[model samples]
Target: MKGKLAAAMRNLGLCVALAGLTACASGPMDVSGTTPGPLSIASEGSFFIGGHDVHSDTLSTVPNYATSGTVTVGQVYVSYQVPTHARPLSLTLIHGCCLTGKTWETTPDGRMGWDEYFVRHGFPTYVIDQADRGRSATDIETINAVKEGKAPVTALPALFAASHEAAWAIFRFGPQYPQRFPGEQFPLDSQSGLWQQMVPDWIASLPTPNPTVPALSQLAAKLRNTVLISHSQAGIYPFQAAALSPNGIAAIVALEPAECPSATGDLTPYTKIPILVLFGDYIDQSPRWAPRLNACRAFADAAVRAGGHVQLVLLPDVGIHGNTHMMMQDRNSLDVANWVLHWIDTHVTAAAS
Candidate 1:
């Protein structure tokens, strides 16, 4: 009788197998369970040497050969969560001038950054610390040489450093520090963190055929049809990468790019790729930025005339206000991200679907 009852319960799926024992199952069991994690991390770190040399030093206590090299370093760190459902695109975030990938990792005010948000929302986001910045490493000797009015002995590029006060006005946080626009979105209390993002930038390293372009292009190629999101000085990077590989980048979202393809530069390469240029508030009011913004407009206009798909979005015209150049770190950053996501959904994913 006991054996018959046990068999009957097993047939009805009420038994849980255990060591030398069987217990009654508790309600319905989850047959298809999800894994806790084996979260994968893909990281790249390296110094790409431009030149190498040996030097002799006589004042050494121990006999050691002195060696130096002209090199630029690159670090691309990425963590991705596959979308709950399939999506057709990924994102490669490039930081602007003087900043590193950490800029997108967290806001100055300690809010969740765009990188984690996008990854959580299903986009496989890749963040890069461009050559000679952030975790990648920099050539300080090169920087000091430039400061001392010395030209580089090798053909290697030079990096230029900017002042914090200048960045204050230039970023349009305000004309100067401690004097911000009324109701500005940037977190004034965390201004020091923002300043920490500033690093020396390589001159002549972002245009097409430059070493930096190829370095970033390689990353894009690995991503297979990624969308590039660039800010400030990095704005030229996507254009150069896309122009070089043409088919590597699926689209581009440039946030207040400091550089634009010259009006005379070829736009034919970008004709098929969708591009969006976003400008924060106070652009027109900024004497330092107004002229640059004008040039950007001309480039966008010219691109459109040449059959490129381009849209220049001004935040103020769209009802957002008091945003500095660092809108991603602004209070309403998520709102701006939503706009960008919508663009990606409509232009890239929708079309791919």
Candidate 2:
């Protein structure tokens, strides 16, 4: 078929483009919101930040278990890719509760995720696993000690894992499981992919604001001109980071945040940096989400009153519909990403000058 032949030719072209990484590093980027182009990657690597080592209760002589009676925990892991001639601002993405950096990765239908999308658009991209999640290691000694009766049962860290049934409601798929909102964009058939991303969240044990907040500040300082993009439970980190240290932070993009910085808190931290609070559809019908939306609205209003650059947008108002909490993994994820990219270009880059 003609379509199949065209597809094969385009695939061949992409391979050719990828092979030209260093040679065409400054090639024109694709901002048209279609399949990205100039697939050149100049550098790609990962690192860990924040956290500290804790003394382990049991010291073992086993080769793999050997340590100086200390184990490293609470460090946040970051994977970064810098395209040749990357834009001035770098994007740092953090995931929600029960998720990892994987939230910004390939969609359930195997479509391109935001990480690769931004890189193709000529911006350095960094994906983070919040402290104690995924590649960001956590302390197991407390759990081990509790099980061994060496530590009191109260010492067991509070870990919360969402059931698929609960996620149905939490993610706003519908009033409950086995149901979906009308015109929903989430890929129903590939739900197993979503479940695969859900992990045990041990946030209750972590310090308030989470170690990732300070680590995010450190990363922002390192990356310089960084735009933080967070979702769900991890949403408040950027605001906290900005308060902790506003240097090097260019902007904040929060997607369906669980909570916003209190309206009563010092609003001076956000006075310069642009902030966007985005939400998907059906919040009016969601008992939990409605209140959250109201709270975010209040914070945005307060931030604006405090002379901060804050704006709130509901997807439906912008004609993007049927998105659940995990908008990055939705069927039209690239469209969503393109919109956010446009915001960065307009607000951060333009405002800088």
Candidate 3:
């Protein structure tokens, strides 16, 4: 009976599998080669998951239909592509605080993004817009209330929108706006493209840990044997998700996370998975990022001592340098992505074999 119940639960989780007919084709990526082979995809689609209805007080003066419950907030948007020859593990890419899943779509200078590269490499790639961010719907009940005078000024949600100047320091583009760290791999000529991707972050209004963390856990079950690849603000979600539900999570690749799980936190979930925590260059220079790197190293050490499979890779140590906080979008983005793919093949796939 217990086994049957588990099977039913798994089936229920997978019921939301890719609802796609969007065509895709790419041969496995060859970073070293001059060209990539033709691509082929068996399925590709997009869908939303894990949202709760946020019914606002029926206020007058708004559009007639909107005066009714108004919105379904917190549901996450996911788009996926499954290759013709899929691998044993699928990948789910999560964007950071201000950006959307478009982070993985293309480089600012118009290079192939990691999403396509991974999909072409035979891992079904899934990318998500976190709850109340990016393509995900926002909870505008408060916005409606304020405009209608139904709520006080103080009742307004504090939304955070990052300016390009602030993003310069935050994303490690340079010491300041309009400056460049020598050899910085960020494509400076197309920086306006990066700013275009920024949007207002609704983190202040969303629940702690956000709906996206739980949604990630659910996605793991749906994708089955998945690797959760996260960056910057999303660095911790995969760990948090794995903590909640370890089943179906095969590995984790965290790229320059804002913070790593505490070295003292419960680490049982990590013992069962292969984990990679990677950081880019310029840590010692920036007081902000240096601590984060230290924290991850401490966490990695603790996880390793506890018999968990964890590796913390510093980019410069591997001879790849000049990466900023946004390493995945750097000039050497594909180089970084290819290195990760190689790591997956070596650690995850080879171990499974």
* lDDT for model 1: 0.69
* Candidate 2 Cα outliers beyond 4 Å, as residue runs: 1-38, 59-68, 350-353
* lDDT tens digits by residue: candidate 3, 110-146: 8778898887767889999999887788777777678
lDDT (Cα) of model 3: 0.83
Find the candidate with the highest lDDT and give its number: 2
Candidate 3 residue pairs that clash: 25-39, 25-40, 26-39, 26-40, 27-39
- The residue-by-residue lDDT of candidate 1 on 221-242, one tens digit each, is 7667788899998888888888
lDDT of 2 by residue, 300-346 (tens): 99999999889999999999999888899888787788788778878
Give the range of the ten consecutive residues with the poorest summed lDDT in model 3: 9-18
Model 1 residue 34 distance off true place after TM-score fit, in angstroms: 26
TM-score of each: 0.74, 0.88, 0.88
> What is the C-alpha local distance difference test score of each model?
0.69, 0.84, 0.83
Runs off by more than 4 Å, candidate 3: 1-37, 58-61, 349-353
Score candidate 2 by lDDT.
Answer: 0.84
